[model samples]
Target: MAAGAAPVTTESDCRCDVMAVTDRDCAGVTACPGDRGLLLVAPGGYRGRVRDPNLTRSAAGQLSPERRATDLRRLRTERFDVLIIGGGVTGAGAALDAASRGLKVALVEARDYAAGTSSRSSKLIHGGLRYLEQLEFHLVHEALTERGLLATRLAPHLVRPVPILVPLPAGESLRDLPARAFRRAYYGAGVATYDAFAGVFGGGRGMPLHRHLSREGARRIFPSLRADALAGAIRYYDGQVDDARLVVTLARTAASLGATVVTSTRAVGLIRQAREVTGVRVRDLEAAPGSPDAEFEVHARVVIGATGVWSDDMSRMLNDVGLRPGIRVRASKGVHLVVPRSAITGETGLILRTASSVLFVIPWGGHWIIGTTDTDWRLDRSHPAASARDIQYLLDQVNTVLDRPLTTADIEGVYAGLRPLLAGEADSTSKLSREHAVFEPMLGLLLVAGGKYTTYRVMASDVVDRAARRLGGVRPSRTADLPLLGADGYAAMWRDRADLARRHGVPVGVVEHLLERYGTLTRELLALIDADPLQASPLAGAPEYLAAEVTYAARAEGALHLEDVLTRRTRISFETTHRGLESAGHTAELMGAVLGWDAATREREVAHYRARVEAERESQLMPDDATADAARLGAPDVRGFAADRGVDGDSVELPTSSR
Candidate 1:
């Protein structure tokens, strides 16, 4: 398990005796029974052998502190073929695409991975059904194709099929029957076309086709729907994912393929020579104050600006150096509200039309995520605040069809994200296109902006295709055929869920949850549970996640701060009614042990997290964007604090030593 060491596995290393059932019949007490017994395949079927519990301890895929340091050293010393700015899904995907195609790649994120628009997405991996109404068949086809690939071939563990119900307004009387019929025909044709596109591009993979339901059937499926709200409903299948996890997984997958993925790093300036972009000037946001290497430069043959909403700022940086800008990005803010499952009794998700954008009542694990309002935002790009007006707007729209309206008290979490809409003459943000455009604004520089989360893979493929032309002899994108880290052997692992539960001495539900989140990578967590059974216990306040997950975030997921573990690594921050406050202390302590934080550092981490929750609460009470942004700024950024405080005795210094 040493750094760069190959995992040792043999044909006789099968551990089938650990579990007595297959994933199908195990009910949750068995392990996967592969052809060669209970031997699990490592990611990408590397070596085609059973994975050693210790193999994950190596430098290959483990995003440990040691790996981070190693990657940082490489970023400073080595010249890469492509250096990507931004660590959201698009950037991460681009890095994976470039690295897999045999290009030397390095990726830097100003904040944590998916800490921007990527994680704040609606969490759907479907073709934009509304786009069909806009007559955007090409966009729909591309998105559907990528959705199919994600659910079937790529990140199967993180992406799965979800059914959505669209309710039709009820008629006033028998005399209004013709109008109702017309409404049904109109909506029904649109849905039928959606299914047709999926059939053609989705490869007929995952989830059932669309189906029409009577009022009784709709009510039966969603008893909480208002009796007068709908005469009938349409049910269709789409895919959903843990958006944050997908971004992190993409980074990890790229790292495993030899790309340098560094978080807590900011790209401050573009390094140019003559008229060609050469590299990037980056600052380690986590570095101690006045540290010599805190701000350094990385050399690369080409640099890509994949920053989402900050795309314009990146373009401005090039303009500052006299490079002509080829693209402009308009920022649109979308906010979502998370409430407990008791708020709405629905077996399937609900999608409703609004004045501008569509609103979705998605069924999360133990909550319903209802959102969002699309409005132009000219406030803070880092933390877009969800104002009281934004929350009220959502509540009003969703309340129109719900039997029991939700109040502010029912809201567990509120989040706002800014979309990088490609700037056009369109007056409204909702009218902007989701289609992306890639441009080489300058020699050796590629800029990609404006694409939906569902079509990220396509966007990545397209950007890399353009980059590949500049770097001659580079291979074409192979990501279409490359399954993400946890995707390999997922079908077999699912079958052995029961056996895995039994092997780990946990409930079937816990195993199932782990399987969905980590896929075949669940074994790494199982190893932690085996080493210390205490790790298998549910989190102190949030029972939805295991305590080991918090530790794993630090040990293997490159989590450098408490917020990264609580908010992005797991959904504890938003899923819990306490907004992760009650669990903050315990979660920080767990991460502290793995990241080598002292007692003061641990306490500081907890304090900062509490302040963040409070700031969000205060922001939610504000009436407008300006006031909300001001309120949100009341909580100082933890990384910013680190940078400002430097290595002074008053502040706890971030540990530079490897864990």
Candidate 2:
């Protein structure tokens, strides 16, 4: 094959041609054999349809079966300037930041990218308004700056300004009126300061500042709020992003800049010598028959641990000889409820203050996402289930202002996640600070924890900066100006989306969705659907996503399992009415074919998911963390991970935490 030409349509294709694209999985897109009758995928993008020409079939970090046989392969066979564990935003950002600066980088995640807290967020890319109350001005300012960067320069397609209204009760005390005014002024000042701060950091000036609204004005903007409930309100502008897409874009950007990223691969053991850490031992969880069972070890000079909640384990494994670093992580469980948008008929979202912290009723694609109760969590860090009590707590809080209350029947989905905080014993986890802490625990081991979603880039940059000294003076962080894949030239893509939609026979809205999720890379998914237009139809039960997205996730993004596709990649688990239970089988079937799973394997996946939901339902019925943890343990592993996979279930490793 020619240098820039696409690779052959078989597994035994030329290695050099495959290397032309970064080692990311391009499965169906680049690997499938297409019908050969002059199928023009995209007029100027790709010429032929023998395969998807977007390099979607090349799986990263999966160079060859031989290269993947042992752990520490990079440490012994080759050297990487930086080795990043955890494929969440922090790790993805680290890879992008390091590789963009001419550092040889490799990032590995025990699960799929963003499988942890990254994918399970409330999906807002906003400056923390609550931080202003805590007087964390610097953190708020930094977050606002990043929000602007993502909205305009970095990922305009993914991040957009969402209008949020904070209501004030009508029958409040005279003193309460003054207090609300004071809060408005303080919040306004902070927002102005944020706007000015963005100017200094070279961020965009597109979004407006915070505005105070009268009772009538507030009612006009948000009709769902009871007319008598509000004395006045405040309207603020913030960024909202597809959290999973952001993580994938970061990983793609890193791969584009020459970093090797792999998913469905686990870091089972750390490769180390006396008093110094070197690399990792990884095993492919879905290996084919006759595949070697031993771990693959990759050597690297510096290993920065970006594994958020798993930081303690990574740190402990790195240092078996020296005094271990203090375990400073506290896991807080946050639960969210998804209801149909008809429940709240309004334009702007509501951010209601509650005794527990705050309740956000945000609009998400024809649905209202009301959530987030923060409490102590002591079990099941991987899949924090939403129990009956958690659901009731959210419903009771949200019912305070709603004209008509919501019940279980109105619920489309419920989800829970564990947030990693600096270890503390506060009475309420909601009171914990959103600030981050980075520690160099021992030689070659950097552990980072205690940051919120908005500041993941800063957290990653700081971690890499600390480990840079060990890399013999690496370059300073340049992630601020760097745009993730699909971010660059997004504005132009948005302008031409209508034409692209017409050309591909897809709806204009579908084009918009694609641009929002993948920016210019939407063409890649469109091209795949163009080959087999049936794939272009949305998934049966979950109409929010196209069937092509599942294939794209497995091929382009590193989705190796059904759970990775349904839960993280497309949010089928949290967006559907049944929490994806009704759609799980079809999803498994589609994902199974792509991943090479037989009927037995598919049945196991379905059973595991069902048990998980049941366990979560049981856990939510409990009042406290201990009982919830115990109930949640009723379900076994959903992925049925092999013995060689990272975690061993000899004993349950539930996170014990306070506040």
Candidate 3:
């Protein structure tokens, strides 16, 4: 390994020529990569051609289709020091950590990156405040430390502080005065302790201290709050992010550090040499079942499973390979609904304590995210369905404080994700502690599961540290201080955003949006637009996203299907009033151009996405989890294998029933 030189991806083979951002440091900064004419890089850098038509130059962290193809070849032939399954936050983090430590690492995901629980989180990066009530001080402290790191250092561009209010309800009469005083004292003390923990841990909270406001003051800040709802409110700050975007950034960061990151690839069976795991037999979900290239074995010194709820399924794979699983994971469903920001006339987000758990009303761009219910889920883990009852429960809970009650018509989007809680004896899923566990049941396999999103980097560090112990001579983790792909020199980039917008002939507001979504990587999109100025035009249906963004997702963000682009890469699926139906065809077209899809393939992609939206709508109408799950399954998966792994097909099918 050499300083300022790209890490070679595979052993004894120059499969890819991954050039670091720039050959020379520019004015002692990483943001300006030498006039920004990137040389596209990949596993097999390039074929016989001087330049690739699809990809322009060698850019570190770009997961172009060519890179995936080359990486797949490497996965089938090369040996790695560490192999990580699951492309969620933790798995991606692990890959980055291991790769930066100078180890050969490969990561495979069953679906798109952040396709499961990682993308559907409440979008908050905070130490669990309620955990303080549970006397889980260590957990809170650890999580707070990580939060500070993400907000201030690790991913300052992506993670930002958001103000939240805890409304103090007014008493009905003098008889209830004691309850009011008690509520204020208890909550105030808990919040003060939370601040103290943050102040003592890491560097600091990285946001303003909590503030107590009078009833009139709170009402003035939140005009839509019912006059009789609260006596006052306590406002504090927590970090928030586009969860799916964060995961994508992590994967890109891992790739930039020489980790082989692939999605739409699943672990089907464990490759074992009698009681010891040697590698994994993986199924390329993108490949047709039973095809010659459908499945391949990836060899590694140590194998780790970071699958969340899918942790139990890894146990099944172990059973097939004559190994017993050591980790037990329970799935808890969390549902969130998105509505226009105008639905709630509030300047700050709200946190409400419910009978069983806490609920958050988070402020998204031009939208409000209200959620979530904590209940055990036994149905489909891949597509956890949110039922009508669940939606009603959230509405009822939030309506207690809002001047105007919300209805189904107010919802623009709904999503449900499963939380992997470490199996415990607690009767309710809400009672289960948000703690993670790691296991090495077999000689070469490591299993890490069950933790809150806030501590993903910590979890990644722990799992990799264990794996390093098995593979001697590995270096310590370097992720705590290391920034993600777009993090370094972000402040300078943001400071010159106006000049950047002017140089690119784009609006300052547009530049601001790109900076928030992509820090220094915004240059990539600007480059794409420069190549084809037409791509600068916003989508007809979803004006918030430029056409270039869709192409960028396909070319550099590892988006294989239409749903991946709509739902995760850009979030147009949930942000739009039509739930992305109005934008599906155009999105597919833009993605098709990069993915090399013909007319028929593009049509199929559009059809599949539309059917998925409808199925989600129908499922939301269902009264119970079972019915909702069944309704949601009516739409076949864009990745055929995601619907049912046993299904025999290579095509991302669009059935007439769903259409």
Which number leads on lDDT? 3
Q: Which stretches of candidate 2 lie above 4 Å from their native place?
A: 1-77, 172-202, 288-294, 318-320, 424-427, 641-659
User: TM-score order of candidates, best first?
Assistant: 3, 1, 2
Compute the lDDT of residue 295 as modeled in candidate 2.
Answer: 46
Tens digits of per-residue lDDT for model 2 on 135-245? 887877778777777787777878888888877666657767777677767656765665566556527754676687888898787776787777788787677777887
Each candidate's lDDT (Cα)? Answer: 0.81, 0.70, 0.82
lDDT of 3 at 622: 95
Query: What root-mean-square deviation over C-alphas does model 2 reach?
Result: 7.7
Of 2 and 3, the candidate ahead on lDDT is 3
> Worst 10-residue stretch by lDDT in candidate 2?
650-659
Residue 267 miss distance in model 3 (angstroms) = 1.1
Per-residue CA lDDT of model 1 for 409-433, tens digit only, reads: 8999888888889999999999999
Q: TM-score for each prediction?
A: 0.89, 0.84, 0.90
Return the top candidate by TM-score.
3
Q: Rank the candidates by lDDT, best first.
A: 3, 1, 2
CA RMSD per model (angstroms): 8.4, 7.7, 6.0
What lDDT tens digits, residue by residue, belong to model 3 across residues 1-659? 22243433332333222222222322221111111122222232230111122232226678999989988998998898899988888888888888777677899887889988899999999998999989998899999999999988889989999999999999999998899889888889988888888888956568789988889998888888888999888998899999999999988887765678888887777788978999988878788667999888999999988888877666655565565767788889999999999899989999998999999999999999999999999887778899999999999999999999999899999999989899989999999978888898788988899889989998999999999898876667778777777777789999999999999999999999998998888998999888999989998689988998999999999999999988999888888779899988898889888888999999999889889999999999999999999999989888775454322353221110100
Candidate 1 global CA lDDT score: 0.81
